[model samples]
Target: MNSDRLFTRFAIGINAAWLTLFALVPIILILIVSFLKPDPNFFVLMHFSPRSYLTLINPIYLKVFARSLLLALITAGCCLCIGYPFAFILAQLKTRFKPLLLLLVIIPFWTSSLLRSYAMVILLEAHGILNSFLLRWHIISQPLHLLYTNTAVLIGLVYCLLPFMILPLYANIEKLDLRLIEAARDLGASHLQAFGKVIIPLTLPGIISGTVLVLLPAMTLFYIPDLLGGAKSLLLGNLIQMQFLYTGNWPQGSAVSIALTVLMSLLLLLYLRLIPKAQRSQPL
Candidate 1:
């Protein structure tokens, strides 16, 4: 018994050490690099400085940050709006059909996100199937500027992240006791009232989780915005990319990355405050 207990403790320590090395170390390195001054050549860091952080306050970066935030919020909102219904349906389905419905939701994730965005570009372009079909149906006089627009980016993002939103919601809604809803109805509450007062509160944790999952990735996404929104519609991700590749300013890029990381951490903290302790303690 003593040997078994000792081995268990040793294994836990080893796993914790591994996580610290792989995850914590990289984050610390990035934070350190963000405060360093870039050299004239090779964009190498020579010494620690606060100038990189000061540059983060420039109007251009601030605007990009705001735009990214708005985009993320909109994406999360749309995901919730669309995902909740599907999740509700899935939760009410027969046990045998649940796996099939989940498969349908998860199928898109098997493909690369980059490839999926490119496919959206092909589908939404002027001569693409969407426009062609609309023209054939006489829905429009001409192909609209659907590609290379913010709307296109939003469409692609929602498609990619929808599964993340739906799965969590379905899990939570499945665990919800249907008897409570039935009881509310028996007490003369309307369906809307029952849902608003009972269902929404119970499912709030899943909603918050899905929102965070979508928003965090959406804010930092570069490829979707680059492919669909075009170079002209810049977001924070694009700005960071530019600093690294176009401007060759490693320190500035690292600073932008660090700032985004901090902002996301803060958002996650706020999200945690909204969820009930019981719901949050559930396994993801």
Candidate 2:
């Protein structure tokens, strides 16, 4: 018992120390910097000012925020549509190849997402594989003009984040009580009705988890929007990156960062609130 208690205390201490150094400290620094005045020469001044936050409230930045949220929503929605069916099929599979198939899903994580975005460039360029195939098949008379567009950005976000949406859903669906679905069907419910009444209610947690995962990353993945959407499609992430790295405006960047963090925190709070409600509302 002493050994176990010692191990637990050691593990807790390590986690607490790590979080304090990495997560909590960074957040505190950012919060402090957000209230400081931006100095062109120093990057941050000790003088406290709300100018950074005032800048965030400008109409132009508000529009960017709205657009960023919209894009994130679309990415999460697309991931849900694609991931749900795929996860359901994978979970229902009885084949020994399941692990191999799941491994294929995870292989992408072994690679850099930067490389993945560049790979998307190759696929989305006018004469890339996707367009070339379409051209050969006479799908269209002209190259689809895919790269450096919102479409390309959306595709890239979905491609990169789909796995995040799938794994949780697969875990949830694998543990689903199929008999409940069958019972709904036997009670004169159609397939669609049974799905709505049984499968969705039980799988709500997975759907919410996957969506939140995709949504949060979609908001903050700066490189994808930069590489795929071009300057014309600036997002909150791109704005923050520009302020800090390109423009050397640390205060403004931290302000934007705090605003975005608040938005994301609200989503997390919603997740926490809704998850228990979903559990309680699950059909017997």
Candidate 3:
């Protein structure tokens, strides 16, 4: 028993150390950098200022923030709508082929996201497969210009972040006690009523988990917009990338990064706090 206790403590200590060294250290460094002054000639000047945070209030930066929030919200909502149904169906399936269906979901992840973005470009381009198929079918007189639009960006965001949403939801849904659903139905609840009173409450944790997974990434995935959406719109991720890589403005970049980290941390805290409450309220 003492040996087991020692092993548990040792494992927890290792995890704490790992988080401190990797997560806490990087965040502290970024926070410090966010307050530093930018220099055109140097990486950063010695002078300290809050100019980076101040710059975030600029109209252009505010616009980017708004866009990022809107896109992330929409992406999460879409993923929930898509993923919940998929996860529910996948979880409730009893066939021997269930694993094969789940494998198909995992298959897309095997390909590089960059490669998939390029594939989206090819499909979305004017002379590409989608347009060609549409044109061949006389769907339109002319090839529709689908690239470089908000719709295109949303498509890319949803496509890439969907799996993140689905996996978490699946994990939760699979553990659900289907007997509760059956009991609800037996108690004269309509299908919709049973779902509303039964499935959703139990799956609240999964919904939150999936939303966080999709929402956070949607706000910060730079390449999908760059490649698939033609860089017409900039999200927070693009803004951060431009500040650090293109403009060499590391302070502003760090500020954006810090802002993102704080936002993510808040989401995580909420998720952690809410899960227990959800579990407590869960119908037995």
Clashing pairs in 1: none
List TM-scores for all candidates, in order: 0.89, 0.89, 0.85
lDDT of 1 at 279: 82
lDDT of 2 at 217: 90
How do the residues 76-171 of candidate 3 rate in per-residue lDDT, one tens digit apiece?
Answer: 998899989999999989999998998888899999888988898899899999999999999987998988887888888899888888888888
Alpha-carbon local distance difference test for all models: 0.88, 0.91, 0.87
Error of 1 at 54 (Å): 2.3
Per-residue C-alpha lDDT of model 1 across residues 177-272, encoded as one tens digit per residue: 999999999999999999999999989899999999899999877899888888677888888888889888888888998999889989889888
Question: lDDT per residue, candidate 2, 198-255, as tens digits?
Answer: 8998899999988998999998887998898886878888898889998999999999
Sorting all predicted structures by lDDT, with the top scorer first, yields: 2, 1, 3
Q: How close to the true structure is residue 47 of candidate 3, measured as C-alpha lDDT?
A: 85
Clashing pairs in 3: none
Per-residue lDDT of 191 in model 1: 92
All models, RMSD in angstroms = 2.7, 3.3, 4.1
Give stretches of model 2 more than 4 Å off: 1-18, 277-284
